[model samples]
Target chain A: MHEYSVVRSLLRQVQEIARSNGGGAIETIRLAIGEFSGVECTLVELAFRDLAPEKIGRQAKLEIQNIPLEAKCENCQQNIIITNYQFCCPRCNSQQVRITAGDELTIIDIELREVGVNA
Target chain B: MNQTITVNRDLKADLKEQANRFRQRMSDQGTLVVNLVSSPGAGKTSLLQRTATKIGDEYRLAVLVGDLATDRDAERLKPYVPVQQLTTGGACHLEIPLVESGYERLNQSDLDILFIENVGNLVCPASHDLGEYLRVTLLSVTEGDDKPGKYPKMFRTSQAMVITKSDLLPYVPFDVSSAVEDARRIQPELDFLTTSSQTLAGVDEWCEFLVRQLRKIQK
Candidate 1:
């Protein structure tokens, strides 16, 4: 349900970024989606595929890179690598941990052809 | 030669910034904003109505209700306080703009507290901070005892986990203690309250809690 909202914002950013750059035909939009971003990547991809054709970046390709979660234990100060949402510290079995990675939702870069540029 | 525009923008972080601005505004106005989230039919409105009955006059209170459509909840709550409904049309969660606009419409100069009842959902609402001084997530017994474990996102983020519909405990197999235990495991500092809207058993207690929070803010 919220995937639509996510796509709408993404598209808005795409247009704004393109406009700021004096306009461009967005060739590829790259995104880094973290594991704990609370957004379903498949849903976002579906939204982009459905809505983009009628709006900005009609032929833009969406490339997503999934970021795995990493946490720092509050007790032992150890960096614990997570795989399947097991948040507890592996060494000390402490639950007090701060998530350091894999919760971001950010656009990395956009490959675009500048206006009045030859193919 | 080719060019790669390095423009990195984060939307979720932007939402957090918006929510922080709202919080600062509320703090400057000396108003306590509390956001309530729950599943559909989890007794959020009923509890609010019951609280209104018990202590509606104790403070200057206003409500902003969000749903997909309809002002039905607003109508139910109008008698007690200034209630406004925000129909999202189809958005599962109420974002910062909708909430800010709704509160701005109230225009109550001396309002003491504002309650924003989020669109009934456990998943979507948990992620969006509506600049609430307090965030409460409700769970009814009929929904089952494993809700906290199954949906940890809502429980993990909430300041308090309210167990509503306690009157149905006898008819249903919901364990109040176990539910509290499960939620506390995820959030050890989380406050727990057992309430029954029909009986109004915990209504006064919850009302008192709000009054206390309001008074704390004033001091």
Candidate 2:
């Protein structure tokens, strides 16, 4: 559903980057999809594969990096890993916490072919 | 030759930079921007209508309403204050670029507060930054109390969490304290208020809170 829209925006960014950097055909685009980013990576990849080829990144490959959830505890002042959507502090059992990472979506890298050069 | 490369590191950093730039530019003119985020039917437009009605004349208020289609919300708020309907054209969130362009289109000489009602989706809008000084997210009582846990990013990113449609509390089984507590679990200092446009319950206090935020930015 919303994954399609995410793909569209991702492709738009890729296209802009490819065009601006001397009109090179995109080879691979690396993206990081955080666990809580609310974007489904599988659906995003599917849509990107379906759509990017029609645009400037025809031969482009998509590399997705999975980001895990990380949180900090309020009571123990300790860092705990949220493995299974369990946000409470492991030691203190305090629900007061903060999500330090794992909710992100961005184009971290783009593999671009040199203009007028073939590989 | 095809070689792989990495680009941006921190998406939130980039977004924060863009937002700060916008804030600096607007600060020079003493204008405060409020970015409103919520799910569909969460009473965002209704809240805007109430705010406009209550405090439109006090400040030079203008709104940029975002939606996938139709300027109906803009039209509804137009009579009260200046409004621009930005059709995202199927995009679920309003990015900095679009908001920048929308601000240009507004072309106002002096605006005390500019409210941008983002596309009615909690998931996407929570991730995108629109360069507003204040980010207020609303969760209606009718939508249940688990929204804070279900959509943690919205509550995490927003400066204030507004629980809308409190008048329906008697009919619905939503627990207000549970929702508030859930939101606080995500962000300890997150400010929130509950209100219903129908009963005028806490509407005045909500409006006052918004005004206080604007005034803080002005000072």
State which candidate has the highest TM-score. 1
TM-score against truth, every candidate: 0.94, 0.85
lDDT on C-alpha atoms for all candidate structures: 0.84, 0.83
Deviation (Å) of B81 in candidate 1: 1.4
Q: What would the per-residue lDDT of candidate 2 be over residues B1-219, giving only the tens digit for each residue?
A: 765556775535555687779878887788889999999989988998898889888888999999999998998888887888889898788878778888889999599999999999988887777878888999999999988878876787788989999989999999999998888877567898998988878889998998888878788
Instruction: State residue B201's C-alpha deviation in candidate 2, in Å.
Output: 1.6
True contacts kept of each: 0.57, 0.57
User: Which residue runs does candidate 2 get wrong by more than 4 Å?
Assistant: A1-26, A56-59, A72-77, A83-88, A92-99, A106-119, B6-17
- Return the lDDT, model 2, position A32: 89
Model 1 lDDT, full chain set: 0.84
In terms of lDDT, the poorest run of 10 residues in model 1 chain B is B1-10
Residue A82 C-alpha lDDT in model 2 = 81
Compute the interface RMSD for each candidate structure.
2.1, 3.3
Clashing pairs in 1: none
